[model samples]
Target chain A: MNEILTQSVFFGMFLTLACFEIGLWVKKKAKIAIANPLLVAVILIVAVLTLFHIDYENYKKGADYIQYFLTPATVSLAVPLYRQLSYLKKYPLAIIGGIAAGVLTAMGSIFLLSMAFGLNHEQYVTLLPKSITTAIGMGISDKMGGMAAITVIAISVTGITGTILAEAVCKLFGIREPVAKGLAIGTSAHALGTSKAMEIGEVEGAMSSLSIVVAGIMTVMSVPLFATLIQ
Target chain B: MKFLRQIAIIMGISFLAELLEALIPLPIAASMYGLVLMLLGLVTKLIPLEKVEGAADFLIEIMPLLFVPPTVSVIANLEALKSILVPLLVICISTTILIMAVTGRTAQSLMRIGRSGGEKQESRTVDCGKNKMKNKLATGEEEKTDE
Candidate 1:
């Protein structure tokens, strides 16, 4: 029984699911934005792994399967975008412009800020795609010679912060339009932020969902372009 | 059986994207390919929304659950991250607010221009029925205030 529990594949799967369930329960009870399921799951999994002396490589045997699903999960983002197609068509210029501007600001600010702080090249590059989804962010990080691990951390942090503070930021800015609210959350924080967008309104939900894809595509294109131009 | 078929359709799209990723050698991730192809398929009416909606929704719903492992792997490099943790946190929080404000303001201003151009307001109602109802309720309350 103990051996089965330690087996890499089963261990990884069990820990992942168990941690996520616990995280969900905490979120349900706490009803707080900071009770992010992913953060909780990460903390629990890390603690368990450390206690058991299980290295990440061993844990990855089962976890990689979950990671692999990220591809199809990203593909599935199309459904919401499709559901709101007419909305997109009606205001293509505004939607496109807003996302383009958001993507540029996200990338440009990170680049300039990292430079001001004297972060080394790799750190700056790792942060370049931080606002995009992890699936695409990791890919861009790999291509740009950055650390995928760092990008993941940055992406997670950005997502959590965006999810937690989206409402207050919108209110502070007097951003009453649902479309703007959704785009802002999705652009900066990806799907985690979109989840917050859902709580606001359906218009915000749909717009935020659309922004995830648009911002991702724009960031994917722009990051490499900027990398080469700077070099 | 229906759910299985829906899952297959999504996986099939993902497989195709992987194939393209291998062939093209572009910097883009295969998932992006899948996402774009799925969008095109939906746009062209090649795939009905109902056919894949169930699987797609489930996948999105559990999306955070899937990232648990990758996020945990950060443990391996905590030593390296420790020195920069404070800086990273500050940058992330500040930039989130900056991105939110800029994007929201820009989108809102563009929308104002669009509305002023006399784009049919009624057409917007068809896009999201629920939001329209909520907007009516809020405006109704606002009208009472004016009286």
Candidate 2:
């Protein structure tokens, strides 16, 4: 069985999609933020691989095809951002400043905490881009000599946390405005938080998507500068 | 055929962005370059929204699935993560809440300021109009005011 599965060109891809579909179904039935399809799929896939004692490399063979779409997906983010450009025009300063504040806070907090925790430079850099999307964050992590896989994990955890706590945080902070709410989520949690923002309202959804793009670009530009602080 | 063409355009931009990443001295990602290029094309009307909207939306919709493989690979690195797990969790959760609070407040306050400023300007204009109407009534130009 192992030999057959390993030799088949489509096995890994099949497993990935199948698991993801199951995850989607679970999320639909659960109706909860914590039941994130991506999270579910990751756990399912990891369990299957471990139980079967299949090598990670063999699974990666077909899974790499799915990963290939990441670039196009990242590029496609521009569509929503463009669609939300009207909001930018309406509250240009507020929107820009909100996202800027979020980005700065994300980097600054990580830097200070990592220093306090005595994290090495590489570890610190890996967490620097945690608040941004995986596609961009992974790139920043890899370029800065941090572990990309760890960065991916950190990003996923951060996103899930954002999704779960978005509303409570807003209420606590008195962030009543829809645009500000969206910016807060997107800046802190990336696309995953944007999903929660979309659930909140249309304006929030638009602003959240806009924040993903703006915050991503800002993080990419500023990460190099922040990386120098710990090193 | 249309979907195929749209994907081709997106892939073309991505490829160009890859080339730009190599040629440029900056540390920007190819994906970032692609995003900016796509936005510029759209904003300039060089690329019609309909040209890429369908494919782009489809791609974005399935984005979560794309990250599955990369994330699952984390299992292989669990050893390295074990030691720092506590600190990592602390930072991720704490900073997430902190960022949300800071960003939400900054945007909310700035928006309030912008709104108040706009309201003040609007009231000033209204006051000027009222003063003009009073002057016209005093001059027996009430007919113009009514018109």
Candidate 3:
């Protein structure tokens, strides 16, 4: 048993996912907050690694196998997109147009402010794509010569911040409708924030989910343009 | 039928983007380039947003899972991140607040564009869609009064 726990890649993934399933059960019984099982798993794994004095590469020997699912899972996002076809077609211009303005303002403001505030080139580059999903943000950072590690940290913090305060900002600015609230959360913060927004209502969750893809595409389109603008 | 076609187009575009990424040696990762390429195809009507929304939504739904690999990578590269910890922290907080405030306000202003436009009455409805209108217009506004 000890050897199984110690050396088996399957054991590691099973243990992690078992914890995740337990998290699902926990959420069913109680109010699930930022202290989610997956998030806790992150903390737990980190702690276990430190306690055992195990190198991350050693853990990856197990964890990397699970990582293979990321791509197919990502490709799966298309399901919801199909369901919301009527609304998507109805507001084609409005949705895309709104996201365009949102993405440009997001990238442009962060870039200019970071540059003006005395950040070095690398920091400026790292900060450029913070609003984007972490995978893409890290990719942009690498391409533009920013630190990928810093970009990941920045992306996580951004999602966390958005999770914590988006509602406050929504209310502060008077975005009270479910769709608006959802869209704002989804567009600005991506998936993690959408989970929180789902707590608000179904409409918010639906709209928020829709916003993630629109915002993602919009952000991607703007990357090259923004990268050149900053340079 | 329509839904399936859109899914096909999006996946097709994604594959093409992936292929292109391999052909081009950009500093960006090929997956990201695939993403960018996919987005261009969608927005330009080359792929059509309607066609890809299904697959895109499914992918986005599972986004939290996507972070798992990276979070692991985070642990793997924990030592590397430590060297640049302070600046990374600064970038995260400041960038979050700044993006939230600026985008929120900009979106707010765009929502407010009805005051002088010919349809000011409809503009508020557009700005913060009445509950019924919201259901009708998926892109409509919210109660900005929540501010």
- Total backbone collisions for each predicted model: 0, 0, 23
After superposing candidate 2 on the true structure, give the runs of residues whose Cα lies further than 4 Å from its correct spot.
A195-202, B119-147
DockQ of every candidate: 0.43, 0.32, 0.26
Better of 2 and 3 by TM-score: 2
lDDT of 2 by residue, A71-128 (tens): 7777887787788777688678888999999999988889999999999998898889
- Docking level of model 1: acceptable
Across A1-231, the per-residue lDDT of candidate 1 in tens digits comes to: 335544757778878999999999999999887888888999999988888777777788888888888889889988887877777877777788878888888877887778777777677777888888887888888889888888888888898899888988887766667777888889989877876787687678778878888898788779977665333
True-contact fraction per candidate equals 0.72, 0.71, 0.29
Instruction: Candidate 3: list runs displaced more than 4 Å.
Output: A1-7, A19-32, A92-94, A112-117, A195-210, A217-231, B1-17, B23-62, B101-147
Docking class of 3: acceptable
lDDT of 3 by residue, A30-81 (tens): 6635545456566667777678776666666666666654443333433443
Report clash pairs, candidate 1.
none
At residue B44, what lDDT does model 3 achieve? 59
